[model samples]
Target: MAESLDTALVPAHVAVIMDGNGRWAQRRGLSRSEGHRAGTRTAKAIVTRARELGVRHLTLYTFSRENWSRPKDEVALIFDLLVEYMKGELANLLDQDIRLLVLGDFDGLPFVARQSLAHVMAKTAHCRAMTLNLALNYSGREEILRASRALAQKCAAGTLEPESLDEAAFAAELYTAGQPDPDLIIRTSGELRLSNYLLFQAAYAEFYFTDTLWPDFDAAELERALADYQRRQRRFGKTGEQVAE
Candidate 1:
């Protein structure tokens, strides 16, 4: 399937909203934890597929700040699965030359989970082929606020002139600082909204939404999304005639 894709049409950065895990489990009369486990498996496969399809950056909304509002037991299980995944996939990540990057405040995570992430990230620090970002405990609004505060601090200290602030300067403080903004953002489970994911970074991103749940999303579905993206005409803010010219 990857061989069929035109490498030039592939998005440089792809962000996914892996949703509907709990609903998937409910439909099968299984525990939500089981659904999450299945979702994790799907995530792993997609990571490999995306890398093979020439995606340079892949960001997964693994754990959001709003997810903490769910049942505490569920949250705990998610973190446990996260640790297990890190330990299990470290070798595969290294072999694929994929760097592991966190796009959220991982320091606020549980001690054990933090340690696991640190270990995996450290081990994959040298990888250069691709970058995989896990958005743990992340919120777009919070990220913007953090960046704003940092810039404000620099201004207060006279290190940065207020008039010198620009989009590039502001974006430099984001979690995705050195990475390209997402060119494609996919949301599973038929969600029509961004749900506060990558607010600033998604300014001009193309969105792909599917009815399939996160656990059911496969390489074929991903291929479809990418193909759809390739067919679209992205002119930024220019008119079609202007772009054609």
Candidate 2:
């Protein structure tokens, strides 16, 4: 399926809101933990496929800040899975030349999880093929606020003038600073909302919503999304005729 895609149309950066893990498990009479576990496998497969398809950056909404409000046991399970994933995938990440990058407020994560993620990130830092970004403890609102605070601090210190700040300056202060904004953002399980993921970066992104559960979203599904994206004429606020000109 990927072979049929026009490589030129592939998004430079793809962001995914990996949803429906709990429902996937519930429907199968399994625990939410099981669903999350299955979702991790899908994540692994998608990362490999995305890299093969020439996506330079792939960001997964692994754990949101709001997710911490869930049951303690469920939250624990998620962190546990994260640790296991980092430990198990570090070698594969290095072997595939996929750099691991974490977005969001990572310092707020648990100690063991932070240690595991740090080790994997350090080990795979030199990989240049593609970047696999995981959004952990992430909140789009928080990210915006954090960046705003930094800018405010600079202004207070008289290092930056309020009137001199531009879009580039603001973006440089984001967690995704230096990375291309996602050209395509996908949400699985029919979710239509951004859920506070990449609010600033996704301002001009093409969104693809799928009913398929995260655990079931495969390479073929991704191909469909990319193919659809190719068919769209992104004018970026300009008229189609203007774009053609």
Candidate 3:
């Protein structure tokens, strides 16, 4: 029989690299937007499963900062989908007390998209349930660089001391300031690359890759990922013996 779902070893933070949407659509002879729409539905299911499995933080690789250069129509559809999704999920989010967080640089997005995101964030500020972080218009490298710039500016302005700059200090400037580093990062669609995702934050995260597309990733896949994470020993610089002890 299989082991009971890693209840004692569940990760507090889980991040996912949702990939293969475009390819999924192409294979199905559907519009890329349709794949994204299907992906959103999958997101809801994954969020529910994550909460059920005791995950406190769930981060999704939504839209990358680099995605702005994609086809104009595709980009527009993405924003439209985001707005519709927020409107559709608002009631359910409030009822379930799920906190919504949008990471990355938002300045490049359209005014309407920003407005929708801001509205949802403000309305969900009091939520106490699992935090759902959507990495919209985000890139990990850019995030860390921006944080570094902020630190430099603070020090130059005399608000922060030069000697106070350190790993913890820099980390505090990241968009995921109060959030824990991802303990497990799953990349779907068999992608081996990170594609500019959560570089600083996933320093020691265990990676799980699957051939399943974003829309195809369901509850069983998540359970499998968690199980894989639990079986591996995370030393974080310690020796195996030390970790075991």
lDDT pick, better of 2 and 3: 2
Q: Top lDDT: which candidate number? A: 1
Candidate 2 matches the true fold with a TM-score of 0.97
lDDT digits (tens) for residues 127-209 of candidate 1:
99999999999999999999999999999999999999999999999999999999999999998999879999999899999
lDDT for model 1 comes to 0.94
Model 3 agreement with the true structure over 28-141: per-residue lDDT tens digits? 999898999899889888988887788888999989988989999999988998898888888877887788999988777789989998999899899977899999999999
For model 1, what is the alpha-carbon lDDT of residue 129? 90
Model 2, span 1-245: residue lDDT tens: 77779987788999999999999999999999899999999999999899989999999999999999999999999999999999988888888899999998989999999999999999998999999999999999999999999999999999999999999999999989999999999999998999999999999899999999999999999999999988888898987542431
Off by over 4 Å in 2: 241-245
- Full-model lDDT for every candidate: 0.94, 0.93, 0.88
- TM for every model, in the order presented, reads 0.97, 0.97, 0.94
Model 3 segments beyond 4 Å from truth? 1-3, 241-245
Rank all candidate structures by their lDDT, best first, as comma-separated numbers: 1, 2, 3
